[model samples]
Target: MPFPFFGDDKSTIARLLSTLPQTGRVEWIGLRPARREQLLTVEEATAETDRHLTGDHARPKPGGKRQITLIQHEHLAAVAGFLGLAMPLAPGRLRRNVAISGLNLLALKNRQIQIGAEVVLEITGECHPCSRMEEELGPGGYNAMRGHGGLTARIVQGGMFRVGDEVRVLEKSSA
Candidate 1:
C-alpha cells in the first residue's frame, strides 16, 4: 500500500517536504588541508560565500555545488554496525566536512540551512562514498557507506560556524 501522504495532490507533497521543524546541531568539523591527507578536526571554521570553507583544500569553482560535505552524526553508529564495530566510527574517518545531529540531512536537499548565526549553505546532493572508503574503513567500507554517505552543499552566505552550533532550515521566503 502506498503512503497516505502520497496522494494525488502535489501541493501537499511539497508542503510536507518543506515542513521540517527540527533543529540540528553541529557535532564535529573536519578540514582536509590537502588531498590524501587525514582530515584535521577543528572547533570552528569559516565558510566563504559561493566558495569552499577557509583552510579546506577544496578549491571549488564559483557557484560550485560541492563547496562542503556533511554527514549525519547518527549514521556513524549505523556504519559501525555494518562493519561489526563495537563503537561508533569517528567523524574524521569518513572525511566529511561536518557531522550533524538531530535533523535528517536527506530532507534538506535543495533547501538552504543556516549554521549558527551566520553561515548559510544550500544542500546540493548526495556525497557518494569514494574508493578511499575501502582504504580508510577497510574491506566493505565502500558498501557500508553506500546509503549512509552524506550530503554535499554550496555555501550561500559566509561566516564563522563552531561546533555545537544550531542548524536550522530556512523557509522558502527567507532562503
Candidate 2:
C-alpha cells in the first residue's frame, strides 16, 4: 500500500544545500519561486536570476542584496539553479537549494505550484550549474547535474515561507 497526502515517497524536499556559512545559518525554510509582476511571462521570470552576480538564492536586505546559494522549487526564478542530480554521484556530496527527488523538473515547466497557504510560483525554465559547483559540491557534482539543473521563476505574490509546508503543483498555466 501507499500513502496519498505524502504524494510520492520517492520525492523529497529541503534535503540540504550546504548550511549557510555559520553565522548565516538559514534552515531549509521553504521551497518557492515567483514572478516579478503579475504580468511578467514565465520567460521573464526565468531570467530574473541574471540580476544576481553571485548566483541564485539572492536576497534583498536593508541597503543592498545578498545571493542565496540555494533556491527551492518555486523561488528558483530569483537565483536560478545548478543541477538536480540523484545523490551519491561521485567524489563528494553536493547540495541543492531545493530537493526534488520524485518529480521531474522539466515536467513542471510553464506550470504553477501551490505551496501551502497562498505561495504560488510559475515554472519558467531550467537552472544550470556554474563554476561554483566545483568548489562547493564534489568534482563530479557539476557534470552530474547537467541539463536537469533544477528550475527558476519570479514571485507573483509576496508572503511568508516555512519548512515542512505542503506543496501542490497545479496544472493550469499562470501566464
Candidate 3:
C-alpha cells in the first residue's frame, strides 16, 4: 500500500508513522533534596503518585506534571559533543532523575510507561533546560541542553524501581 506523505516532507511522514511504543532499560537514577543541591546516585528509588521521588525535594502537590524527570542515554554524548567536550557527560550533571537507554524519550511524550515492575509514569511534557545548566554544564551549557533536555513525567502509580530495571511502554488500554 502506498503511504501518505506531507508533500515533499519526509520528516513529517516519518514522525506520523513512528507512534509505535518502545521499550528501554533504566540505566541510572539520581536524587537530590532541593534545588542547587548536589545530586546523589542511587541503586533504587521509590516513585510516588503525583509526587517526586521519596527523598527528592521538588515534590509538588498532587497533579503536578513534574513529578519525575527522565533523559535518554543516547542524548548525553550528543549534548557533550555539542559543547565541544572531549568526554561523555555524566547523567547526574544533567540533573534528570532517570537515564534510560534503547528508546527515544522525546517520542514517549503523552504516552504511559511502566518502569521496573510496578512504577507507572505518564510523559506529561518536555523537561526544558533551566539556568542551572549554565552553571552545572559550564559556559554554553544551557544552549547545549536546549533541545536535548529530555522529558518530564507524572507518576500514575507508585512503586519502587532500581538501576537496570526494564522500562516498558504501556498499551493504550492499560494506560
Candidate 4:
C-alpha cells in the first residue's frame, strides 16, 4: 500500500504555498547519455524544449513534465548524514543534471524560473530517489534520499546555460 499523504489532498494552503517563485544560481552541470553511463561534467549545456539535455537517455513522455533535473547544493550534507557517510555526497551520483546553490527547489514547484537569462524551466515535481540509490549510495542510500531526492523540471524556453549562471524566478508575464 502507498502512503496516505502521497495521494492528492486538495487543500487551499497546499495550492497557495507552491505558487511562490524563488531565486538561485547554477553551481554545477552534469550529463549522462544513458543509464549506467559515466557522468560528463560540463561548464555549460543547451536545454531543449522537445528533449532533455542534448544526450540524456529519457525523453519527456507525452506530458513532458520532466525535461531536466536539479538538486540543491545545500541538501548534500543532510542526505549524506542520513546515510551515515563521513564524506560529502557527490551530485553526479544523484543523477541530477543541474546543482543550484541558493533557492529551495521545492518552493518553485509549478513555477517558472530562468537560468542564466536564456533558459526557462517549470518545476514539475519532486525527483524521487530511485532504487539505484542503494547501489550507488550504499545500503541505506535509498531511504536516506526519500524527501531529499531533488526536483524534476521541463524546459519552457530553450537556451544555453553555463556554470556560475544566475537563476531567478520569472514573473507571470515574463514567463
- Model 2 RMSD in Å is 14.1
User: Mind giving the per-residue lDDT tens digits that candidate 1 earns over 150-169?
Assistant: 99999999999999999999
Q: List, residue by residue over 1-175, the lDDT tens digit for candidate 2.
A: 5543344444332212111121111124321233221211111112122232122344544222222222333323222233354333321122334333324446556555544465555666766766656655556546645663566654444344444455555655336
Across residues 5-97, which tens digit of lDDT does each residue of candidate 3 receive?
Answer: 555776775667456565799999999988779889999999987788999888687998989999999999999999999887999999999
lDDT of 2 at 97: 40
TM-scores for the candidates: 0.95, 0.47, 0.89, 0.84
Q: How should the candidates be ordered by TM-score, best one leading?
A: 1, 3, 4, 2
Off by over 4 Å in 2: 1-27, 30-96, 100-102, 173-175
Candidate 1 ranges with C-alpha deviation above 4 Å? 1-6
Top candidate when judged by TM-score against the true structure: 1
Give RMSD to native, each candidate.
2.4, 14.1, 3.2, 6.7
Q: What C-alpha lDDT, on a 0 to 100 scale, does residue 175 get in candidate 2?
A: 64
- Model 1: how far is 151 from its true place, Å? 0.5
Model 3 poorest 10 in a row by lDDT: 1-10
Q: Give model 4's TM-score versus the native structure.
A: 0.84
Spell out the clash pairs found in candidate 3: none
Candidate 4: lDDT over CA atoms? 0.84
